[model samples]
Target chain A: MTDLTAAGRGVRRRGPRTRWGRLRERGYPYALLSPPALLVLGLIAYPVVLVVEMSLRDGRAMNISAIGQEPWSISNYVDVLTDGDTYHSLWITALYTVISTFLSLLIGLGTALLLSRDMPARRLLRTLILVPWAVPGVVASVVFLFMLDGSYGVVNWILRSVGLTEHGPQWYFDPSTALAAVIAPTVWKGFPFFTLILLAALQAIPDELYEAARVDGASAAARFRYITWPAIRGTTVLGIILTGLWTFHTFDLIYPLTGGGPDGATETWAIRIYTEAFSFFHPGSASALGILSVVLALVVVASVFPIMRKQFF
Target chain B: MNLDRRQFLHRAGLGTLAVAGAGALGACGGGDTSSDGTMTLDFPTWQGDEAGVKTWWRQAIASFQQTHPKVTIKLQQVPFATYTDTLTSRFSAGKAPDIVHLPTTTFGSFAAQGWLANLDDRLKGTDILGNWTKVQKTMMWDGHNVGLLVLGYAPVLYYNEKLLKDAGVAVPTTFPELIAAAAKLTSGGVYGYGATTTSHPGTYSEATWMVYGAGGGWSAGEKLRFTDPAVVKAMDDYRTLARYSPKGVPSEQKRTLFFDGKIAMMIEGPFVYAGLDKAAASVKSHVKLAKAPFVQQPGYPSNSIHVSTQASKKKADMAWEFIKSLTTPQTQASYAQLYGVPSPRRGAVTQAMIDKRPELGLFQSVTDSAVDATPDNKDIVTNFSEVQKLIMDACVRLQTSSTPTATVMADLQNKVNGAIK
Candidate 1:
């Protein structure tokens, strides 16, 4: 029987006759991996630590010299949590992130499934679908803006002509529609990436498994449930994580569209941090806010990763 | 703004990414200084038409450099939207140019921050400084007497000539006449009047006119008493103006309706006249510029107080000489003829100039009355946006919802006050 300690220590030993001996001979691989491991640690970890350190300090505009001197305080977090003006923005951002991520994944996976089936002219359709990703977010948002314009937008014009809407759909001016409109471009621009990834994952599954399932009298739905889903589940979860992070950090789409205005309906923390730091010149506060947002994002990622691993992998 | 360990570094989020990503759409290729002692003159415009502004600056520079053989000029045009990020990054990285055009609103703050070369000491005896009008006071910061205000626009009410004629409403003067005109023009879905919201740079020019005319001007020391009886009354008076406007008329909306002749009137500065010449020349004949309509107040000016928006025009080596040339009596007349826009100077105005440009009187009178927006230390550009937002919000609430005047005014005051601090 093999002892557990060596495995825990990740130790490999070379001996003549067994599998352990061969694996032990290849132990130098980890040494080669050390550089990247350290690079990620230095790049991702050091900044994270610095930011956390910053979040603990009080910040001010004009007195940039005070950044290092101010003692650690819970005041920033307290103020954010207690401030009535920002609370609604925070709530809206959270709801927006989750809903947009979920919808993006669902639509992405659906498109992936459909495209994977080898329909006629699938390549052309895929090209058309993926084109939105090529345009910069600001440009994409701007184009959509013109398309949804109240008076002369093609979509609104069609709707008005068809008697579906008399005036126009208040996509940006109205509060309820504003949040959704901002989220629309994110899902549109991002869905193609997720679709391609999921499709690749789907394609990687062996054709033999489907044939075997059919031979066993399994229904198409059952075969999909048994084989296709388990195969692509890992990729889907990774896609969701990436999509969620992107949604959480998205600024340009929301900023130009609503400007966190029309009654502050779209004022996400990102918009708040930007306006504070640049517009107001409150660098310390902006950095501190940035750190807080990053920390929250880390916690969100950390929490989600484990859940995804257990449920999907 | 402190983020805890987990949230501080998730730049994968677009918001965090935006910290470094705000202005990457810059046009490459910085202009090179040439042998005519060609110095790179950085020109910033609030909008595009790189070629047009560059041509204007190049011509101006070429003319100025002719007198100074050693001074050659090159123009580097930077779009206004990306100017702050581009110049700021380049400057902090030790790549600042010899001369650059700056808006008057930014002169105080930029000078206070030590970004500009002090011209105050140099301008004292120079013909350039001697020729500068009182309107140039708008560009002077407290400590740094650096820079000069060149291009200027005096704010006023702009009406669509066709719209007013169609509605049979004569141009207004008193508060009652204006309201009646707006009401008559506001029959159905059509709005009668519009002003750019605070989010826009144009809002700063408009709001100062409104508030200064209403018996007050903004300063941190004097906490905005927008809710004070006179201020509140001013706001309520504006609410009446709002009935003739769309629920929220952004700058784009204001520009479109006025150009399309959909809206009857807008609060605008002299820039509209420039736009009329170039972009809207066909419709230009249908637009009329007028003094701000009068407001009723016990102790305030009856006419809406207007102010000039100024910028420094660049000329190499003889920076002072270029400024002097621009402010010269003859040059001012030439400029008036070229653009048919207002001149903001104290010197003699020729009959020939007035014959070419109709509003020379208004421009001349307002030059004496132009409010100096130069702040004590920092750029009003920084604070003006916030002021615009707060006042815009108040106006929106006043117009759309039945939000109480006291509540909105107090809210705006608090936000603006907090920002300046």
Candidate 2:
């Protein structure tokens, strides 16, 4: 009877303590992660929430305080969604992103292939190629502006000297060529990043694979198709995704060059948002457009992922 | 000295919280006053680095400091291109400067937001009400005096006498004549005319002068007249003139071209005279000023000063005092002399000032007859930035495309109407 009473006491003592121990064990990882989780919540999640809230308000409020007093409505979203200019900007953004990304990748891939081969001053050339990427966007835009000046630009001088045409095209002033002109500088700045990434990926390919392919009567083209492409295909896809995203939001080069002018030919979604918010003092509309942009970007990514799934997975 | 994994994480989490809390506190903590009982008043202006205006402001600040030794005036230099946007951002963040200096074109938008303090009572005790020029009326918004107009001037035509003589083009006194002269002067790497042909903020002013010169304006009271025949004709004429200008050049670069004798003629404000000292000697010797070759003269308030509503009572009072010092007759006279332009104060340009600058008389006469370049409509004024954008867009369309001016203007009218509504 005394033995049974001692065993009952032991069970009673262990019950609450065992439950506490289980709780602590389950919560340990979360407790360790709370600091960084909270930081992300504060930094990234909070501003996004604020922007979403701001998008729902109605008014041309320039400040947060004034915006808070504005009436709650979805009119900003309705306005942004219904505006024809929004679609036009989206179209421009697509063209800019797609063309810029494709050109950057092509040039990057070519340069990476060249630099991969044993060549004279290969390291020096590789380092020097990053000069464009190193140049600040604003600085690059300014330099290109001077170089592309229609009347006094060195470009005009060269074109005239080479007997290309009687008069040099007004590269930035004319709408027909402004997009291409702005794209040139962007590609120049963007291609270097692709080169760096793809170059690293290329160096990882085994030389024995190429040597063995050559011995097996595989042509250079066939070798590249079977071995080189498969090896770097994953990195190229990533590079395209990243470069496309960057190009989609390009504002610095375009803003200083043309300001989406000569009839909004170069007006992308990002520039439109900026013009609406700062130039027109319509923050609500700007925020709405921003939200729509995120949605559009997600849609693009989702759609593209399925097509590229086999490579990534 | 040694903690278990959970304890270390708990302490790390606490440390992060404390660090974030400290950062938040630091960001929120801002005081103009120091422990020594000294105060600093934030003053931001695009003119902080402008040649003659910078010198005038330095002298004015020094004089004001002599009387108020405990108060420091912090002059923040923001580039003109980004000045308004920067100010808007600062005001939105509730960190508005104590003394607000705004371009007159952007003043109405700031005042409409109630970001500027009402100065009706402050103006009553001063001579500024009766003694200031007619353009001072621009400072009044919704029947309240909210700012003090400091600079007002008419646009003047600056010509190169040597270029005109070389090209055998007489000084133009009419729009058609001006175009003819500009065309004749174009050759040998020299542009016949200088204009802000690029997509820039100055495009607004450049387009305004052309439309106003032809006796058409963006609006009349609440009615927009963008589709008027006169405006279309003026824009068409402007397009023709642009062909003779350095393509895609901004106003500052256009001025540089003029100073370098690469541009034969340009229309600008009397303030452009302040830059004469920097002009090449060959160009300076041949530079001349005349009334703009247009039927009507374009003029507007250039810039103004105000006390921000965000300022504390003490800071507001100090700002008002500093502004008052700038308006005093002696200071106004000095400003007129230094700036090479007429001050807003009445009788600020004395005979001595005119004698010092023979061109001052023409500037004064032109100022007397000058029409306000900005529209008088309250709605348009309140939504000036939007209207300005629409107009600038229209101007670009006219300049770069073969689009019919009437079609462009009609489209602009619809956009402006929609914007204001």
Candidate 3:
């Protein structure tokens, strides 16, 4: 047994398998990866450090010169946390993210499943579903503005003509419906991303599994539960995670739609950060709010990712 | 040998990258002086190509260049919405233009930060300085002459003659008469009043007219008293005016609807006349302009152009000369005619201008009485823009929600007090 092991060790140390070759193999992936790693360090990691540093300083109204002159303290974070507006904005952000992400994912999953099947005009429908995604966020929001206008909007006109009521709902003016109104356009613009990801996952599932299930006299629902859901669950979780993060940071769509007005009905954390930084000219406060937002996002991903990994993987 | 080759290529690539990055950054530092020894000055204005004003600016620049051959004026135009933010960013980066168009409300904040050059000594004995109006006194901060008003206009009543006549309502000259006319004209798809009652910045200016007219103002001395009984009453009156308006419509949309004849009357400035010619013929024939119906005092919602402190002394003098050229009688007349707004000079409105557009006469009548809506108390209010937003938020709350006027006013007063503190 000792002789056999010695022979195997000698075979492993053949020509061209020298220490330099082993070293190159170990360093090649890292060498290829250094450019992207440096890019992330410069663009993402460095800005994050700056944001944390700015939060600790006393900079307001583009007055960054006060950084060293003023004492570095946690006063900004304290003020933001103690403020009533911060809680209100965070609540709004939570509601907006949860609803928008769920709606976007649901619509995406349904459309992706439908498109995965062979149907008439499937190619054309697949191409056309991405129209909203193709349009820029600001342009999409503007189009929705005209479509939902109280006086001249096509939506109100349609609802009125259908005998829904004497007058259609004042979608933006009423706080009750304003959030839903804004979310409608957001989900519309975001669903196409999910559709693309989920559709690719759906198509990757083998045909033989479904055939075997059918042979076993399994119902369509059973076949879907066993074959389809398992096949696409991992992609679905990833799509939700991404869409949730994007929705949490939704600013461009909401800013033009309501401007965080109608008495702060739709003032998300992103809008609050903008108002603090640009409108109020308090960059320190804005940076504190930004760090809080990042922490919250990480907490959400941390809690959700583990469960999702275990369930799907 | 292979390692040496890889290291050489890496260092070479990095050197090239560093050189390229430095070149790009150096390009952003701005223009160099001409080899012929002419100084180039940047003059940024927010008016852009609106209402044929670009042509007026071009002619004014050409005239200035003819007189000052050693100076070159680079006229830059930024959009009105982002003008202040852009200027502030440029100022922070030390890349501010030699001259800037400073809106009256934001001048205090910039001047307080020492961004604007004082023109006191330069304009002391000049005829241009002698033409300064009492309203322009608000532009002064810390006992220095900071800026000069280039163009100014106040809100006035604009009505469709056919809509008023068809509704059998006479022209209103009082608050009651205007409210009654709006109620009468509320039938059909058309609304009588078209005030931009939203939380838009334009609404703040529009609402200030009512606040001032009601004997309510943003401040008395250095104390900002938004809870002043007069202000609460003014907000109540404003809420009534909005009831007759299409809810949540912005100023631009209001203008479109007014041109379409869906809105019978709107409180707007002389700039509205520029688009009158483009309105439907039916709407055009019925257009009428009148002074604001209920007003004891005129609101000064004017913007001025000023020399930036970042400019060299020599460049600043050139900028001042360019600004002075814009106010010359000839340039002012062309500005009023082409831009359809009142000139800042005391007697810049000529009979020829009135003949060209009769409605401009109404704007001219109010120029002498115009008062800065939120007059700055240099000791107390450091950021006029923040104060303006607070007041605007109060106005929006009162207009859009069922919040009690007194409650909103008290909250606003506390907020303003805190901001100033």
Using lDDT, give the best candidate's number: 2
- State which candidate has the highest DockQ: 2
Total colliding residue pairs, candidate 2: 0
Top TM-score hit:
2
**TM-score of chain B as predicted in candidate 2:** 0.93
lDDT of 1 by residue, A1-313 (tens): 8879887566443343576866755764775577689989999998677656655676542333335676778776666656676667678889778888888888988998899886899989888878877878899888877777655668778988999988776566555566777788778888888888988999999989999999999998998899999999999888888888888878988777767765676778888777665554444455667877788899988988998899999
Tens-digit lDDT track of model 3 for A1-313: 3799889889877745778988987887998789889998999998788789889986453644434455688989998998888999899999999999999999998899899999999999999998888888888888888898877789999988999866676677666677888898999999999999999999899999999999999998999899999988888898999999999999989988887766677889998888777666677898999999999999989998999899898
Off by over 4 Å in 1: A1-89, A205-227, B1-56, B127-131, B187-190, B219-221, B246-249, B278-282, B296-325, B366-382, B395-400
User: lDDT values of the candidates?
Assistant: 0.63, 0.87, 0.80
RMSD values for the candidates in order, in angstroms, are 10.1, 3.8, 3.9
Evaluate candidate 1 and give its CAPRI docking class based on DockQ. Answer: incorrect
Residue-level lDDT tens digits of model 1 in B47-102: 32532233444556677778766665445556665655564444433455555555
lDDT of 2 by residue, B1-421 (tens): 9999779868977997999999999887756677787989889999988878899999999999999999889999999878988999999888899999999988888988898899988988988889887878788898998999888888889999999998889999999999999999999989899988867767788888999878989888767888888888998899889888987777888898999999999999888887788999989999999899989888778899999999999889999999999999999988888888887888988998899788888888888788878788888888888788778777777778888888888999988888888
Q: Show model 3 residue runs off by greater than 4 Å.
A: A1-40, A61-70, B1-32, B375-381
Model 3, residue pairs in steric clash? none
